[model samples]
Target: MFASPAYAQAAGAAGSSSGSTIFMLGQFVLIGVIFYFLLIRPQQKRAKEHRATIDAVKKNDVIVTAGGIVAKVVKVDETEVEVEIAPNVKIKIVKATIADVRTAGAGKPAND
Candidate 1:
């Protein structure tokens, strides 16, 4: 027979392979931690702040809707708001559609 015989790996090589596997798993865990701190945590914080702002909305507050319409809050209900986009022109909108709220006197003059 001209074929060469195959030899099995030494027992010590098995231990090194297991050590490398643990190191690889540790690397994945570290990456997951980095992603949570850099990406996931901040997003959740922003969502919480946005929810608070929406909940604090009341009559006379100026709001910008998700559709980019700027209006004054005429009435605030549990899940909806009545906004006056123009004098005597009001529309009911979902509270969640409000993107930003500007309380009275918070507006600065165009010159400023």
Candidate 2:
């Protein structure tokens, strides 16, 4: 019931060389395209949206940091921002660390 190693390898390689190598190369490209669309494309889109969100932040905007701290923007600089976490308590954080920017009416009580 046992086959020699050399015989087994030759049996496996027998029909494989009859196939077009171009088809194998095309399969790799197809996989690359699928990966780009399913993985890399969405990542790039999210990165673009995040860039737009970070760029639109302004003074008085409420922001949540990547660290999950909520703060009010006090100043906007090229690469950093000053935010007020509490009354008279301000901290400087890098712009890239901001995770979210709240809309105009966000965080305010609706009925008031």
Candidate 3:
């Protein structure tokens, strides 16, 4: 009788172990889904929008560079832009460095 009890307990432990493994795998899958929706998806969307903005940059547009410099786009080349940060102060920056492009008269003061 004692030997039979030992066998029954062993069988029950095997079933419970498999059930716990399934539950653990399910928890991992759920966490991965949550991360994709909450973190990865939104980041990809923003990157796409930023790329569109960078591509649409043109002359005379107000742009903010990645280095935090705000200037006017003097010329838009195939891979670079010449920005005039001040009176007669121009610099050629890579197209990818253009962080944001503001429209004409968008950032100027009303009284000016």
- Top candidate on TM-score is 1
Q: What overall lDDT, based on C-alpha atoms, would model 2 receive against the true structure?
A: 0.86
Higher-ranked by TM-score: 2 or 3? 3
Q: Candidate 1: lDDT of 80?
A: 100
TM-score of 2: 0.79
Task: List per-prediction Cα lDDT, in the order shown.
Answer: 0.86, 0.86, 0.86
lDDT of 3 by residue, 1-112 (tens): 6899999999998879978999999999999999999999999999999999999988788888888888888898989999888878888999998888898777731122
Candidate 2, poorest ten consecutive residues by summed lDDT: 103-112
> Which regions in candidate 2 have their CA more than 4 angstroms from the true location?
1-18, 108-112
Model 1 misplaced stretches (Cα beyond 4 Å): 1-15, 108-112
Candidate 1 lDDT, 25-55, residue by residue in tens: 9999999999999999999999999999999
TM-score to native of every candidate shown: 0.82, 0.79, 0.82
* Model 3 residue 35 CA deviation in Å: 0.4
For model 3, how many clashes? 0
Each prediction's total of clashing residue pairs, residues at least 3 apart in sequence or on different chains, is 0, 0, 0
Write candidate 2's Cα lDDT for 1-112 as tens digits: 4569879898888868657576888899999999999999999999999999999999888889999888888899999999888878889999999999996557621222
